[model samples]
Target: MSTSFRMPSIVAALGLAGATLLCTAHAQIKVAMVMPTTGPLTQYGDMVKEGVTTAVEMANAAGGVGGKKIELVAIDDACEPKQGPVAANRVVNAKIGYVIGPVCSGASIAAAPIYNNEGVVVITPSATSPALTDGKNYQFIFRTIGRDDQQGPAAAKFIAEKAKPKKVAVLHDKQSYGQGIASSVRDDLKKAGINVALFEGINAGDSDYSAVITKLKGAGVDFVYYGGYHPEMGLLLRQAGEQGLKVRMMGPEGVGNPEVNAIAGPAVEGMLVTLPADFSANPRNAAVVAAFKDKKRNASGAFQLTSFAATQALLAGLKAVGDNPAKVAEYLHKSTIDTVLGPVSWNKQGDLNSFDFQVFQWHKDGGKSPAAK
Candidate 1:
């Protein structure tokens, strides 16, 4: 009789514990981080992740959104266009309604349709291609960063007015982001009356850019604007230096990664690139900056604050409208949320109202300073 009574009590206790666990699980809101976890571009993903993670951590610490903790689910697309839809599907299948990034433009473009179609709200922090939203009319897809068209012109103006190169070579990686920005720079250069001697595409990931280096030397191009990431740019700089091609090089934000220092060595010292303006320097962001420092993360990187602002926008929507993705997206479309990037609002097409892109001179020690005039 005693044994039977004890067994029933134990069963009841176990049932109560299971119910509590289920309730706890359902109380948390999950946001998927769609970024490269594997591949050469993982550093970009890490930069974005740091920002998103910091925002989520701070929010959760401050009583969370709607009384529930925010959980991050990392889904790697390797920054490859082919893997974009796969990552999108993984997030969709898991029923996560929000996303922080598909960090690269090609992947973001490839994945935008799926996220929009599935009613998943995605805010990319670093994908800058204007082509991603030019004709898509995606209501659920948005960006915390400026478009490549905006960035391209900024780069071109600096090159035309500041660097004042005699003959320019505009090169791209043959990918959507690279080629699109390169075309923008090339066109703006023409309008600015800066001679573009060579407009070409270099196969990305090829170890031997020596062939192109040779062409650049032959073309008598005194300056180069490479619309690609650091890997190729690093190789170009290193190889160009080796081949005695003494032209100065510049690129978009994609080439600003510190890993370029390892690849280009002293050749990277004077490299110029356009990056999102430094927001960590803002006095209002002191606490946020301290938070980043406490965690040993750099708040001043190109994507960090943008990604944080993306999280803030998403969380603002969630806090306003609960977990309904449709309503949250609608709220985001209508509201300007205060974020690390200041008061930011998206236009009808889900791009920011305005973003400041600044030119910086990169150093061999992985530091950057305002570009000299």
Candidate 2:
């Protein structure tokens, strides 16, 4: 669950411990990545790793954030909400100036207050619950990912306009991320006058969803929307297929990972997901994409570009005021930097200057596109 910031190329020079690298950079501002590199959400943690590492390499090669190479220190929180504060404590004790994650919503929530109190700037690439930015007390918490309020409307637009689903059932894992998104979707669907036949919460980490599937079948729902992670969604999709349920399934970015296909088998065919727009597809990002590919990493789907953007924001702010974490955070309140994701700006509440979400469809063996099937 521990990761080092030093890459192999710099390992021998920096004398990194074993395979894990921890090196110093010009700004003397070490940024930690708090994510789940173990447990059930390992795939998600890996995705975050790919993004952060690629961005760090690119920034370092480009003369670092501000004439200083960037260093990434990572710690695994297992995506558990309770582990969040523990991870934050490590980051604070390590004296890192900034942080880029707590990939899951619950974890992010748990860690935000601690980081804010410590005056550490934190930006999450994936956490997207409306509550994360509610009232905006923690000026340090920021998210490039769209909120559930935004994602819910997008999902509703797809269902009501594109799919024309007559009857639908909404399900969630009942976590902060899941329930918030589900509520948004529910509200949007209700506003659109779509019949949300059933609304239920299924226990996460349980392999059995047959009972829920039974309810779905009897509900005569034409579409099912699940607000949760890939594993639970995969199980539901696979079990639904086994039970001969012919309904369409949709979810938010939480289930968009490619690994979902492997877990669900062919049953994941045509699943719908809502996520931030494809940053790599933007012509302006061609250079960043090329840089990432040169380093043997996929710029697409890995939210690393956003992570890169977060790192850049942190570094740019730091240059304005040495390597002071508190001062850097205060400076981050008003700074714009160009990154792989897009031109970035942060509000005081730690929300992105922009709120954008896109609906994507996952094809079991074909393609996952921003557009619905």
Candidate 3:
């Protein structure tokens, strides 16, 4: 949809490329996976890797994409927005036709234009920033994950009706993903006529948040809604407990790591967080989950199943059109992909065809398990 490119060049290139080979080459299908395999988001990246690897194995066992095996090129982006351009460039330089992930929202937004311009198909599993796809209409970019706009309203509805706290406080890491969802939640809460006692942004990667806890306690906040990954939330939980604050805490899917419980200790008990419904719990995904656990990789996390679904859509498009990136993107845009996360389709903007979200409660005191209650 970008007017920047000459239509003649695209038509010429497609004609030349199509005329040379009507079908996929016998060479292996190389797909690039961009994520933070190291650094703060290492945990989330590991889950995505597991899901993509599992699905790749399944496809290969079935004779692969257009009779060619899949070869994944995993690259680390460290979840930094500044590193997104470089990570995207590495994938493009490798000449991958299809790509999955760039786990963080800021990183995904940064890398999207480059992928779109290069005519590569990218479907992110965990990048939930509204700005990432806003006005891009990038024919090549898509996401299996729903946006904060979908999740924030679900969370606000739950908090307003279920928790019914007298007052709420919203906090975020001030990064793109965190701030986007936090702002959505704030607006929804206001719409529900719930008084948001405080709406503030906090520093990310900080070890101590006693000052923030002190302010929350002084404000007499009944519940705190946070938007960030596990690390900072863990620190806040521990600090809030240390300061004898009794307010309940809630966050988005970014706060669902087991490491959060480890860091927060028992303080995370009874905390609430929203995620896409548990895909592993679906009987339709039994085979997929078994395949992953058989390989000693945990496929039990928020985005991994969505990642699997994205790869499934990618492969489906490949089978439908023989690995043509533009056609694959077109097919994905129009087709309803049956996946571990249920039937997934896409809009013209490359976002999900529908919105889905869920809520869970962390019971660290009860052996650090989520009850989904």
For each candidate, the alpha-carbon lDDT, in order, equals 0.88, 0.79, 0.82
Cα lDDT tens digits for candidate 1, 191-300: 99999999999999899899999999999999999999999999999999999999999999999999999999899989999999999999999988887877789999
- Best-fitting candidate, measured by TM-score? 1
lDDT of 2 by residue, 1-373 (tens): 0122234243332222211344544534477778887788877777677777766665565567557666667677889998888888887776776888989999998888898898878889888887877985787788766678878999998899999898999999999999889989998999999999999999999999999999999999999999999999999999999999999999998898888888899999889988778888889877767766766666667466666676667667766787777777677677776666667777778777786688877888746876644
Tens digits of lDDT, candidate 3, 1-373: 1111111111111121111111122337877778886787788988887778777767766678777877666777888999898888877766778888978999999988999999999999999888998887789989998998999998898898889999899999999999999999999999999999999999998888888998998998999999999999999999898889988899999998888888899999888988888888878777777777767766668888888988998999999998789999989988998888888898899989686787888877523344333
Compare candidates 2 and 3 on TM-score and give the better one. 2
For model 3, the run of ten residues with the poorest summed lDDT: 1-10
lDDT of 2: 0.79
Model 1 residue 234 distance off true place after TM-score fit, in angstroms: 0.3
